[model samples]
Target: MGKIIISTNVSLDGVVQDPDGQEGFRLGGWFGQFGGKDLEAWAKISLEEAMGTEALLLGRRSDEWFAERWQSRSGEWADRLNSLPKYVVSSNLEQPRWSNSTPLTGDVVNEVSKLKQELDGDIVVYASYQLGRTLIEHDLVDELRLVVFPVVLGAGERLFGETSDKKPLRLVHARTIGDGLAFLTYQPVRDA
Candidate 1:
Protein backbone atom coordinates (compact mmCIF):
# COMPACT_ATOMS: atom_id res chain seq x y z
CA MET A 1 0.00 0.00 0.00
CA GLY A 2 1.13 3.51 -0.75
CA LYS A 3 1.36 6.14 1.94
CA ILE A 4 -0.23 9.53 1.63
CA ILE A 5 2.08 12.30 2.71
CA ILE A 6 0.91 15.83 3.39
CA SER A 7 3.76 18.26 2.85
CA THR A 8 3.39 21.98 3.41
CA ASN A 9 5.22 25.23 4.02
CA VAL A 10 3.91 27.09 7.04
CA SER A 11 4.53 30.37 8.79
CA LEU A 12 5.41 30.80 12.44
CA ASP A 13 1.74 31.20 13.24
CA GLY A 14 0.94 28.22 10.98
CA VAL A 15 -0.38 30.17 7.97
CA VAL A 16 0.37 28.40 4.67
CA GLN A 17 -1.08 30.75 2.10
CA ASP A 18 0.70 33.00 -0.36
CA PRO A 19 4.21 32.43 0.92
CA ASP A 20 5.45 32.87 -2.66
CA GLY A 21 3.69 36.19 -3.44
CA GLN A 22 1.33 34.51 -5.90
CA GLU A 23 -1.88 35.13 -4.04
CA GLY A 24 -3.27 38.67 -3.63
CA PHE A 25 -2.25 38.62 0.02
CA ARG A 26 0.15 41.55 0.11
CA LEU A 27 1.16 40.49 3.59
CA GLY A 28 2.88 37.46 2.11
CA GLY A 29 6.15 37.09 0.23
CA TRP A 30 7.55 36.20 3.60
CA PHE A 31 9.76 33.48 2.17
CA GLY A 32 13.09 34.69 0.77
CA GLN A 33 12.23 38.15 2.12
CA PHE A 34 15.58 37.86 3.83
CA GLY A 35 18.17 36.45 1.45
CA GLY A 36 20.62 33.89 2.70
CA LYS A 37 22.33 30.65 1.83
CA ASP A 38 19.82 28.84 4.06
CA LEU A 39 16.96 29.62 1.73
CA GLU A 40 18.86 28.20 -1.23
CA ALA A 41 19.76 25.10 0.75
CA TRP A 42 16.17 24.61 1.78
CA ALA A 43 15.04 24.96 -1.84
CA LYS A 44 17.55 22.36 -2.92
CA ILE A 45 16.40 19.96 -0.22
CA SER A 46 12.72 20.45 -1.07
CA LEU A 47 13.31 19.99 -4.75
CA GLU A 48 15.24 16.84 -4.06
CA GLU A 49 12.40 15.42 -1.99
CA ALA A 50 9.82 16.40 -4.60
CA MET A 51 11.80 14.66 -7.27
CA GLY A 52 11.56 11.37 -5.38
CA THR A 53 7.79 11.48 -5.38
CA GLU A 54 6.01 9.01 -7.65
CA ALA A 55 2.59 10.62 -7.76
CA LEU A 56 0.74 13.77 -6.67
CA LEU A 57 -2.57 14.16 -4.90
CA LEU A 58 -4.08 17.60 -5.10
CA GLY A 59 -7.31 19.50 -4.58
CA ARG A 60 -8.99 21.29 -7.43
CA ARG A 61 -7.66 24.73 -6.57
CA SER A 62 -4.14 23.54 -5.85
CA ASP A 63 -4.15 21.45 -9.01
CA GLU A 64 -5.08 24.46 -11.07
CA TRP A 65 -2.62 26.69 -9.28
CA PHE A 66 0.36 24.35 -9.65
CA ALA A 67 -0.56 23.23 -13.16
CA GLU A 68 -0.41 26.83 -14.32
CA ARG A 69 3.02 27.40 -12.83
CA TRP A 70 5.02 24.15 -12.54
CA GLN A 71 3.74 22.65 -15.75
CA SER A 72 5.30 25.42 -17.81
CA ARG A 73 8.67 25.25 -16.16
CA SER A 74 11.57 23.32 -17.81
CA GLY A 75 13.51 22.49 -14.69
CA GLU A 76 14.17 19.02 -13.33
CA TRP A 77 11.53 19.38 -10.59
CA ALA A 78 8.94 20.56 -13.11
CA ASP A 79 9.75 17.77 -15.48
CA ARG A 80 9.39 15.09 -12.80
CA LEU A 81 6.18 16.51 -11.41
CA ASN A 82 4.56 16.98 -14.79
CA SER A 83 5.44 13.49 -15.85
CA LEU A 84 4.20 11.76 -12.71
CA PRO A 85 0.64 10.58 -12.31
CA LYS A 86 -1.63 13.12 -10.62
CA TYR A 87 -4.84 12.44 -8.75
CA VAL A 88 -7.00 15.45 -8.08
CA VAL A 89 -9.76 15.48 -5.48
CA SER A 90 -12.42 17.72 -6.91
CA SER A 91 -16.14 17.80 -7.28
CA ASN A 92 -16.38 20.69 -9.71
CA LEU A 93 -13.24 20.45 -11.85
CA GLU A 94 -14.00 18.13 -14.71
CA GLN A 95 -10.58 18.27 -16.29
CA PRO A 96 -7.07 19.36 -15.38
CA ARG A 97 -4.85 21.38 -17.69
CA TRP A 98 -1.81 19.29 -16.91
CA SER A 99 -1.14 15.91 -18.43
CA ASN A 100 -1.44 12.57 -16.56
CA SER A 101 -4.18 13.81 -14.22
CA THR A 102 -7.22 11.92 -13.00
CA PRO A 103 -10.14 13.40 -11.08
CA LEU A 104 -11.21 11.75 -7.84
CA THR A 105 -14.89 12.34 -8.35
CA GLY A 106 -16.08 9.61 -6.01
CA ASP A 107 -15.98 9.51 -2.22
CA VAL A 108 -12.72 11.11 -1.17
CA VAL A 109 -11.86 8.60 1.51
CA ASN A 110 -12.83 5.53 -0.44
CA GLU A 111 -11.19 6.75 -3.58
CA VAL A 112 -7.94 7.58 -1.84
CA SER A 113 -7.99 4.30 0.05
CA LYS A 114 -8.36 2.43 -3.17
CA LEU A 115 -5.61 4.40 -4.78
CA LYS A 116 -3.33 3.61 -1.88
CA GLN A 117 -3.92 -0.06 -2.43
CA GLU A 118 -3.38 0.17 -6.15
CA LEU A 119 -0.37 2.47 -6.43
CA ASP A 120 3.16 1.15 -6.04
CA GLY A 121 4.82 4.32 -4.75
CA ASP A 122 4.40 7.35 -2.56
CA ILE A 123 1.49 9.76 -3.01
CA VAL A 124 2.30 13.32 -2.07
CA VAL A 125 -0.23 16.02 -1.28
CA TYR A 126 1.25 19.47 -1.80
CA ALA A 127 -0.28 22.84 -0.86
CA SER A 128 -3.80 21.53 -0.67
CA TYR A 129 -4.73 23.10 2.64
CA GLN A 130 -8.39 22.14 2.72
CA LEU A 131 -7.73 18.76 1.18
CA GLY A 132 -4.94 18.15 3.63
CA ARG A 133 -7.28 18.99 6.47
CA THR A 134 -9.84 16.59 5.12
CA LEU A 135 -7.27 13.82 4.76
CA ILE A 136 -6.11 14.45 8.31
CA GLU A 137 -9.66 14.46 9.58
CA HIS A 138 -10.36 11.19 7.84
CA ASP A 139 -7.15 9.62 9.12
CA LEU A 140 -5.94 9.14 5.59
CA VAL A 141 -2.66 11.00 5.97
CA ASP A 142 0.08 8.62 7.00
CA GLU A 143 2.77 11.24 7.42
CA LEU A 144 3.28 15.00 7.50
CA ARG A 145 6.33 16.89 6.29
CA LEU A 146 6.22 20.50 7.43
CA VAL A 147 8.75 23.08 6.24
CA VAL A 148 8.38 25.83 8.81
CA PHE A 149 9.79 29.28 8.08
CA PRO A 150 10.77 31.76 10.77
CA VAL A 151 8.16 34.46 10.19
CA VAL A 152 4.66 35.24 11.31
CA LEU A 153 2.04 36.56 8.93
CA GLY A 154 -0.36 37.15 11.88
CA ALA A 155 -3.20 36.01 9.57
CA GLY A 156 -3.68 33.76 6.56
CA GLU A 157 -4.56 30.15 5.79
CA ARG A 158 -3.34 27.79 8.51
CA LEU A 159 -2.30 24.16 8.38
CA PHE A 160 -4.53 23.16 11.28
CA GLY A 161 -8.07 24.39 11.63
CA GLU A 162 -10.96 23.98 14.09
CA THR A 163 -12.15 20.70 12.66
CA SER A 164 -8.74 19.11 13.12
CA ASP A 165 -9.01 16.67 15.97
CA LYS A 166 -6.14 16.18 18.35
CA LYS A 167 -4.10 13.29 16.98
CA PRO A 168 -0.77 12.05 18.28
CA LEU A 169 2.16 12.51 15.95
CA ARG A 170 5.71 11.32 16.50
CA LEU A 171 8.57 13.37 15.16
CA VAL A 172 10.71 11.17 12.96
CA HIS A 173 13.16 13.68 11.53
CA ALA A 174 14.21 17.30 11.87
CA ARG A 175 16.56 19.50 9.90
CA THR A 176 17.36 23.19 10.13
CA ILE A 177 18.01 24.89 6.84
CA GLY A 178 20.28 27.90 6.44
CA ASP A 179 17.52 30.48 6.17
CA GLY A 180 15.98 29.86 9.58
CA LEU A 181 13.75 27.23 8.05
CA ALA A 182 13.07 23.96 9.78
CA PHE A 183 12.05 20.79 8.04
CA LEU A 184 10.06 18.53 10.35
CA THR A 185 8.86 15.08 9.50
CA TYR A 186 6.09 13.48 11.58
CA GLN A 187 4.26 10.20 11.52
CA PRO A 188 0.93 9.49 13.16
CA VAL A 189 1.02 7.07 16.05
CA ARG A 190 -1.02 4.05 15.29
CA ASP A 191 -3.54 2.93 17.83
CA ALA A 192 -2.37 0.15 20.05
Candidate 2:
Protein backbone atom coordinates (compact mmCIF):
# COMPACT_ATOMS: atom_id res chain seq x y z
CA MET A 1 0.00 0.00 0.00
CA GLY A 2 1.19 3.46 -0.80
CA LYS A 3 1.58 6.01 1.95
CA ILE A 4 -0.24 9.32 1.73
CA ILE A 5 2.29 12.08 2.11
CA ILE A 6 1.68 15.82 2.39
CA SER A 7 4.41 18.18 1.27
CA THR A 8 3.79 21.84 2.04
CA ASN A 9 5.73 25.10 2.03
CA VAL A 10 4.96 26.98 5.18
CA SER A 11 6.16 30.01 7.09
CA LEU A 12 7.54 30.24 10.59
CA ASP A 13 4.16 31.30 11.92
CA GLY A 14 2.48 28.31 10.23
CA VAL A 15 1.01 30.38 7.44
CA VAL A 16 0.71 28.52 4.13
CA GLN A 17 -0.70 31.29 2.08
CA ASP A 18 0.52 32.69 -1.26
CA PRO A 19 4.24 32.11 -1.02
CA ASP A 20 4.89 33.52 -4.48
CA GLY A 21 2.66 36.56 -3.91
CA GLN A 22 0.70 35.50 -7.02
CA GLU A 23 -2.64 34.94 -5.29
CA GLY A 24 -2.89 38.58 -4.24
CA PHE A 25 -1.97 37.90 -0.63
CA ARG A 26 -0.25 40.78 1.14
CA LEU A 27 2.49 38.43 2.29
CA GLY A 28 2.83 36.78 -1.06
CA GLY A 29 6.22 36.14 -2.65
CA TRP A 30 7.80 35.40 0.69
CA PHE A 31 9.63 32.45 -0.81
CA GLY A 32 11.34 34.49 -3.48
CA GLN A 33 13.48 36.40 -1.00
CA PHE A 34 16.04 33.66 -0.85
CA GLY A 35 18.67 32.83 -3.50
CA GLY A 36 22.11 31.31 -4.04
CA LYS A 37 22.76 27.98 -2.32
CA ASP A 38 19.46 28.10 -0.49
CA LEU A 39 17.48 28.35 -3.72
CA GLU A 40 19.54 25.67 -5.44
CA ALA A 41 19.28 23.25 -2.53
CA TRP A 42 15.55 23.86 -2.14
CA ALA A 43 14.91 23.29 -5.83
CA LYS A 44 16.93 20.10 -5.82
CA ILE A 45 15.08 18.77 -2.80
CA SER A 46 11.69 19.52 -4.31
CA LEU A 47 12.65 17.81 -7.53
CA GLU A 48 13.90 14.80 -5.65
CA GLU A 49 10.64 14.47 -3.78
CA ALA A 50 8.67 14.66 -6.99
CA MET A 51 10.89 12.10 -8.63
CA GLY A 52 10.33 9.66 -5.78
CA THR A 53 6.55 9.90 -5.79
CA GLU A 54 4.42 7.52 -7.80
CA ALA A 55 1.60 9.95 -8.40
CA LEU A 56 0.39 13.41 -7.48
CA LEU A 57 -2.66 13.77 -5.24
CA LEU A 58 -4.03 17.28 -5.25
CA GLY A 59 -7.17 19.35 -4.81
CA ARG A 60 -8.94 20.64 -7.89
CA ARG A 61 -7.67 24.16 -7.43
CA SER A 62 -4.14 23.06 -6.78
CA ASP A 63 -4.17 20.72 -9.74
CA GLU A 64 -5.35 23.45 -12.03
CA TRP A 65 -2.85 25.91 -10.61
CA PHE A 66 0.05 23.55 -11.07
CA ALA A 67 -0.99 22.44 -14.52
CA GLU A 68 -1.28 25.97 -15.83
CA ARG A 69 2.08 27.08 -14.49
CA TRP A 70 4.07 23.96 -15.29
CA GLN A 71 2.74 23.33 -18.75
CA SER A 72 4.70 26.25 -20.13
CA ARG A 73 7.97 25.52 -18.39
CA SER A 74 10.53 23.06 -19.68
CA GLY A 75 13.00 21.44 -17.34
CA GLU A 76 13.60 18.31 -15.32
CA TRP A 77 11.17 19.43 -12.63
CA ALA A 78 8.46 20.46 -15.04
CA ASP A 79 8.79 17.26 -17.02
CA ARG A 80 8.54 15.14 -13.92
CA LEU A 81 5.48 17.02 -12.66
CA ASN A 82 3.68 17.17 -15.96
CA SER A 83 4.30 13.54 -16.78
CA LEU A 84 3.19 12.08 -13.47
CA PRO A 85 -0.29 10.68 -12.92
CA LYS A 86 -2.47 13.13 -11.06
CA TYR A 87 -5.44 12.27 -8.88
CA VAL A 88 -7.54 15.33 -8.24
CA VAL A 89 -10.21 15.43 -5.54
CA SER A 90 -13.00 17.23 -7.30
CA SER A 91 -16.58 16.12 -7.66
CA ASN A 92 -17.44 18.62 -10.35
CA LEU A 93 -14.30 18.31 -12.42
CA GLU A 94 -15.18 15.92 -15.18
CA GLN A 95 -12.53 15.23 -17.84
CA PRO A 96 -9.38 16.75 -16.40
CA ARG A 97 -7.53 18.87 -18.92
CA TRP A 98 -4.04 18.13 -17.70
CA SER A 99 -2.11 15.23 -19.09
CA ASN A 100 -2.50 11.92 -17.24
CA SER A 101 -4.99 13.52 -14.85
CA THR A 102 -7.98 11.79 -13.35
CA PRO A 103 -10.77 13.17 -11.17
CA LEU A 104 -11.42 11.05 -8.13
CA THR A 105 -14.95 9.78 -7.57
CA GLY A 106 -17.05 9.16 -4.43
CA ASP A 107 -16.22 10.59 -1.01
CA VAL A 108 -12.79 12.14 -0.74
CA VAL A 109 -11.71 10.03 2.19
CA ASN A 110 -13.01 6.82 0.71
CA GLU A 111 -11.39 7.47 -2.61
CA VAL A 112 -8.10 8.30 -0.98
CA SER A 113 -8.27 5.19 1.15
CA LYS A 114 -8.81 3.10 -1.93
CA LEU A 115 -5.99 4.81 -3.73
CA LYS A 116 -3.61 4.10 -0.88
CA GLN A 117 -4.42 0.42 -1.03
CA GLU A 118 -4.27 0.19 -4.81
CA LEU A 119 -1.03 2.05 -5.40
CA ASP A 120 2.43 0.70 -4.71
CA GLY A 121 4.39 3.90 -4.05
CA ASP A 122 3.93 7.23 -2.36
CA ILE A 123 0.88 9.38 -3.15
CA VAL A 124 2.05 12.92 -2.58
CA VAL A 125 -0.15 15.94 -1.91
CA TYR A 126 1.32 19.35 -2.57
CA ALA A 127 -0.01 22.80 -1.59
CA SER A 128 -3.60 21.83 -1.02
CA TYR A 129 -4.67 23.49 2.19
CA GLN A 130 -8.29 22.34 2.26
CA LEU A 131 -7.37 18.84 1.12
CA GLY A 132 -4.56 18.73 3.66
CA ARG A 133 -7.00 19.57 6.44
CA THR A 134 -9.37 16.84 5.32
CA LEU A 135 -6.56 14.29 5.16
CA ILE A 136 -5.16 15.32 8.52
CA GLU A 137 -8.58 15.25 10.18
CA HIS A 138 -9.34 11.81 8.78
CA ASP A 139 -5.97 10.46 9.91
CA LEU A 140 -5.15 9.63 6.34
CA VAL A 141 -1.79 11.32 6.04
CA ASP A 142 1.16 9.08 6.86
CA GLU A 143 4.16 11.31 6.25
CA LEU A 144 4.14 15.08 6.58
CA ARG A 145 7.02 16.94 4.94
CA LEU A 146 7.33 20.64 5.57
CA VAL A 147 9.75 23.17 4.08
CA VAL A 148 9.51 25.91 6.65
CA PHE A 149 10.64 29.34 5.54
CA PRO A 150 12.17 31.65 8.10
CA VAL A 151 9.51 34.35 8.25
CA VAL A 152 6.49 34.94 10.41
CA LEU A 153 3.38 36.03 8.65
CA GLY A 154 1.40 37.45 11.57
CA ALA A 155 -2.00 36.97 9.90
CA GLY A 156 -2.89 34.35 7.39
CA GLU A 157 -4.62 31.04 6.93
CA ARG A 158 -2.75 28.42 8.93
CA LEU A 159 -2.01 24.90 7.67
CA PHE A 160 -3.74 23.14 10.55
CA GLY A 161 -6.96 24.97 11.31
CA GLU A 162 -8.64 23.27 14.24
CA THR A 163 -8.31 19.59 13.51
CA SER A 164 -10.61 16.94 14.99
CA ASP A 165 -7.86 14.91 16.63
CA LYS A 166 -4.53 15.32 18.32
CA LYS A 167 -1.96 13.89 15.94
CA PRO A 168 1.37 12.92 17.46
CA LEU A 169 4.08 12.91 14.83
CA ARG A 170 7.48 11.22 15.02
CA LEU A 171 10.30 13.21 13.54
CA VAL A 172 11.93 11.28 10.72
CA HIS A 173 14.17 13.84 9.07
CA ALA A 174 15.34 17.39 9.60
CA ARG A 175 17.74 19.43 7.55
CA THR A 176 18.52 23.00 6.63
CA ILE A 177 17.84 23.27 2.93
CA GLY A 178 19.79 26.27 1.76
CA ASP A 179 20.07 29.16 4.23
CA GLY A 180 16.82 29.86 6.03
CA LEU A 181 14.63 27.00 4.87
CA ALA A 182 14.29 24.10 7.24
CA PHE A 183 13.10 20.83 5.75
CA LEU A 184 11.33 18.75 8.37
CA THR A 185 9.79 15.33 7.86
CA TYR A 186 7.45 13.76 10.41
CA GLN A 187 5.46 10.56 10.44
CA PRO A 188 2.14 10.53 12.28
CA VAL A 189 2.04 7.97 15.08
CA ARG A 190 -1.10 6.08 14.25
CA ASP A 191 -2.72 3.82 16.82
CA ALA A 192 -2.30 0.22 15.89
Candidate 3:
Protein backbone atom coordinates (compact mmCIF):
# COMPACT_ATOMS: atom_id res chain seq x y z
CA MET A 1 0.00 0.00 0.00
CA GLY A 2 1.08 3.57 -0.58
CA LYS A 3 1.56 6.16 2.10
CA ILE A 4 -0.06 9.56 1.84
CA ILE A 5 2.37 12.27 2.88
CA ILE A 6 1.56 15.94 3.44
CA SER A 7 4.74 17.75 2.45
CA THR A 8 5.12 21.53 2.40
CA ASN A 9 7.10 24.46 3.74
CA VAL A 10 5.65 26.49 6.55
CA SER A 11 6.44 29.51 8.68
CA LEU A 12 7.25 29.45 12.34
CA ASP A 13 3.67 30.47 13.04
CA GLY A 14 2.45 27.58 10.88
CA VAL A 15 1.50 29.79 7.99
CA VAL A 16 1.62 28.01 4.61
CA GLN A 17 0.06 30.72 2.54
CA ASP A 18 1.78 32.53 -0.32
CA PRO A 19 5.20 31.12 0.32
CA ASP A 20 6.21 32.32 -3.14
CA GLY A 21 4.58 35.77 -2.76
CA GLN A 22 2.59 35.19 -5.95
CA GLU A 23 -0.74 35.26 -4.15
CA GLY A 24 -0.27 38.88 -3.07
CA PHE A 25 -0.79 38.01 0.55
CA ARG A 26 0.88 40.70 2.67
CA LEU A 27 3.25 38.10 3.99
CA GLY A 28 3.74 36.53 0.62
CA GLY A 29 7.06 35.25 -0.63
CA TRP A 30 8.16 34.16 2.82
CA PHE A 31 9.76 31.11 1.25
CA GLY A 32 12.29 33.22 -0.65
CA GLN A 33 12.81 35.87 1.99
CA PHE A 34 15.70 34.02 3.60
CA GLY A 35 19.07 33.51 2.01
CA GLY A 36 22.61 32.04 2.23
CA LYS A 37 23.52 28.57 3.50
CA ASP A 38 20.16 28.03 5.16
CA LEU A 39 18.29 28.66 1.90
CA GLU A 40 20.57 26.28 0.01
CA ALA A 41 20.04 23.59 2.59
CA TRP A 42 16.27 23.98 2.43
CA ALA A 43 16.31 23.79 -1.35
CA LYS A 44 18.44 20.67 -1.27
CA ILE A 45 16.05 18.95 1.09
CA SER A 46 13.02 19.95 -1.00
CA LEU A 47 14.69 18.68 -4.16
CA GLU A 48 15.43 15.38 -2.52
CA GLU A 49 11.77 15.04 -1.47
CA ALA A 50 10.52 15.77 -4.97
CA MET A 51 12.91 13.27 -6.52
CA GLY A 52 11.67 10.54 -4.24
CA THR A 53 7.94 11.31 -4.35
CA GLU A 54 5.97 8.63 -6.18
CA ALA A 55 3.07 10.90 -7.08
CA LEU A 56 1.61 14.35 -6.44
CA LEU A 57 -1.83 15.08 -5.01
CA LEU A 58 -3.13 18.60 -5.25
CA GLY A 59 -6.34 20.62 -5.02
CA ARG A 60 -7.68 22.49 -8.01
CA ARG A 61 -6.29 25.89 -7.03
CA SER A 62 -2.96 24.41 -6.07
CA ASP A 63 -2.79 22.56 -9.36
CA GLU A 64 -3.38 25.79 -11.22
CA TRP A 65 -0.91 27.65 -9.03
CA PHE A 66 1.87 25.14 -9.54
CA ALA A 67 1.28 24.78 -13.26
CA GLU A 68 1.43 28.52 -13.80
CA ARG A 69 4.82 28.71 -12.10
CA TRP A 70 6.49 25.39 -12.94
CA GLN A 71 5.22 24.44 -16.37
CA SER A 72 7.64 26.71 -18.24
CA ARG A 73 10.61 25.98 -16.09
CA SER A 74 13.24 23.38 -16.93
CA GLY A 75 15.67 21.82 -14.47
CA GLU A 76 16.10 18.70 -12.44
CA TRP A 77 13.44 19.58 -9.87
CA ALA A 78 11.06 21.07 -12.40
CA ASP A 79 11.42 18.10 -14.71
CA ARG A 80 10.76 15.68 -11.90
CA LEU A 81 7.66 17.54 -10.76
CA ASN A 82 6.32 17.95 -14.28
CA SER A 83 6.67 14.29 -15.10
CA LEU A 84 5.23 12.92 -11.87
CA PRO A 85 1.64 11.62 -11.85
CA LYS A 86 -0.58 14.42 -10.56
CA TYR A 87 -4.02 13.85 -9.13
CA VAL A 88 -6.08 17.00 -8.68
CA VAL A 89 -9.13 16.86 -6.48
CA SER A 90 -11.92 18.97 -7.93
CA SER A 91 -15.55 18.68 -8.82
CA ASN A 92 -15.47 21.25 -11.60
CA LEU A 93 -11.98 21.31 -13.01
CA GLU A 94 -12.58 20.68 -16.70
CA GLN A 95 -8.98 19.96 -17.55
CA PRO A 96 -5.74 19.90 -15.59
CA ARG A 97 -3.05 22.22 -16.80
CA TRP A 98 -0.09 20.21 -15.58
CA SER A 99 1.36 17.26 -17.42
CA ASN A 100 0.32 13.71 -16.55
CA SER A 101 -2.55 15.06 -14.51
CA THR A 102 -5.89 13.52 -13.62
CA PRO A 103 -8.96 14.93 -11.92
CA LEU A 104 -10.67 13.12 -9.05
CA THR A 105 -14.30 14.21 -8.89
CA GLY A 106 -15.82 11.69 -6.53
CA ASP A 107 -15.66 11.50 -2.77
CA VAL A 108 -12.22 12.77 -1.68
CA VAL A 109 -11.76 10.09 0.96
CA ASN A 110 -12.65 7.22 -1.35
CA GLU A 111 -10.50 8.52 -4.20
CA VAL A 112 -7.48 9.00 -1.99
CA SER A 113 -7.94 5.61 -0.37
CA LYS A 114 -7.97 4.10 -3.82
CA LEU A 115 -4.81 5.96 -4.75
CA LYS A 116 -3.07 4.62 -1.66
CA GLN A 117 -3.88 1.05 -2.67
CA GLU A 118 -2.84 1.55 -6.27
CA LEU A 119 0.52 3.24 -5.79
CA ASP A 120 3.52 1.73 -4.04
CA GLY A 121 5.41 4.69 -2.65
CA ASP A 122 4.93 8.18 -1.32
CA ILE A 123 1.91 10.08 -2.58
CA VAL A 124 2.98 13.56 -1.59
CA VAL A 125 0.49 16.38 -1.03
CA TYR A 126 1.90 19.84 -1.61
CA ALA A 127 0.24 23.14 -0.74
CA SER A 128 -3.26 21.73 -0.82
CA TYR A 129 -4.50 22.78 2.57
CA GLN A 130 -8.18 21.88 2.09
CA LEU A 131 -7.42 18.46 0.68
CA GLY A 132 -4.82 17.88 3.35
CA ARG A 133 -7.37 18.59 6.03
CA THR A 134 -9.80 16.09 4.53
CA LEU A 135 -7.15 13.41 4.17
CA ILE A 136 -6.00 13.98 7.71
CA GLU A 137 -9.48 13.84 9.12
CA HIS A 138 -10.13 10.60 7.27
CA ASP A 139 -6.90 9.13 8.70
CA LEU A 140 -5.48 8.71 5.24
CA VAL A 141 -2.39 10.86 5.73
CA ASP A 142 0.45 8.71 6.93
CA GLU A 143 3.15 11.34 7.36
CA LEU A 144 3.72 15.05 7.44
CA ARG A 145 7.03 16.40 6.17
CA LEU A 146 7.21 20.07 7.11
CA VAL A 147 10.19 22.35 6.58
CA VAL A 148 9.68 25.19 9.00
CA PHE A 149 11.32 28.47 8.24
CA PRO A 150 12.35 30.95 10.93
CA VAL A 151 9.82 33.71 10.39
CA VAL A 152 6.43 34.10 12.02
CA LEU A 153 3.85 35.47 9.67
CA GLY A 154 1.23 36.81 12.03
CA ALA A 155 -1.62 36.66 9.54
CA GLY A 156 -1.99 34.17 6.73
CA GLU A 157 -3.47 30.79 5.96
CA ARG A 158 -2.15 28.19 8.34
CA LEU A 159 -0.94 24.69 7.54
CA PHE A 160 -3.78 23.21 9.56
CA GLY A 161 -7.50 23.94 9.52
CA GLU A 162 -10.60 22.95 11.46
CA THR A 163 -11.43 19.28 11.97
CA SER A 164 -14.36 17.63 13.73
CA ASP A 165 -12.01 16.13 16.30
CA LYS A 166 -8.41 16.50 17.31
CA LYS A 167 -5.98 14.37 15.36
CA PRO A 168 -3.05 13.36 17.52
CA LEU A 169 0.37 13.13 15.93
CA ARG A 170 3.64 11.47 16.83
CA LEU A 171 6.83 13.21 15.97
CA VAL A 172 8.92 10.78 13.99
CA HIS A 173 11.82 13.07 13.01
CA ALA A 174 13.07 16.53 13.75
CA ARG A 175 16.24 18.33 12.63
CA THR A 176 17.55 21.68 11.59
CA ILE A 177 18.54 22.52 8.07
CA GLY A 178 21.56 24.79 8.15
CA ASP A 179 21.02 27.64 10.63
CA GLY A 180 17.53 29.00 10.06
CA LEU A 181 15.28 26.15 9.06
CA ALA A 182 13.86 23.11 10.81
CA PHE A 183 12.64 19.90 9.19
CA LEU A 184 9.97 18.14 11.19
CA THR A 185 8.25 14.91 10.29
CA TYR A 186 5.17 13.59 12.05
CA GLN A 187 2.83 10.66 11.74
CA PRO A 188 -0.75 10.45 12.91
CA VAL A 189 -1.12 8.23 15.95
CA ARG A 190 -3.64 5.61 15.03
CA ASP A 191 -5.88 4.42 17.78
CA ALA A 192 -5.18 0.91 18.96
TM-score of each: 0.93, 0.95, 0.95
The TM-score of candidate 3 is 0.95
After TM-score superposition, the amount by which residue 159's alpha carbon in candidate 3 deviates from its true location, in angstroms, is 1.4
- The true-versus-predicted C-alpha distance at residue 160 of model 3, in Å, is 0.9
Better of 2 and 3 by TM-score: 3
Model 3: worst 10 consecutive residues (lDDT sum)? 34-43
| lDDT (Cα, tens digit) per residue for candidate 2, span 16-97 | 8887788998877877764335878889889999899999999998887887788888899999999999999988988776
Give me candidate 2's TM-score against the actual structure.
Answer: 0.95
The global C-alpha lDDT for each of the candidates, from Candidate 1 onward, is 0.85, 0.88, 0.91
**Alpha-carbon deviation at 135 in model 3, angstroms:** 1.0
Find the candidate with the highest TM-score and give its number.
3
The collision pairs in model 2 are 20-29, 21-28, 21-29, 38-178
lDDT of 1 by residue, 1-192 (tens): 889999888887888888778788977787767324677787787788778788999999888888888877988877888898999998777897677999999888999999999987779998899988888888889999998888878888898876645778999999887748888999988782
Query: Which portions of model 3 show Cα errors greater than 4 Å?
Result: none
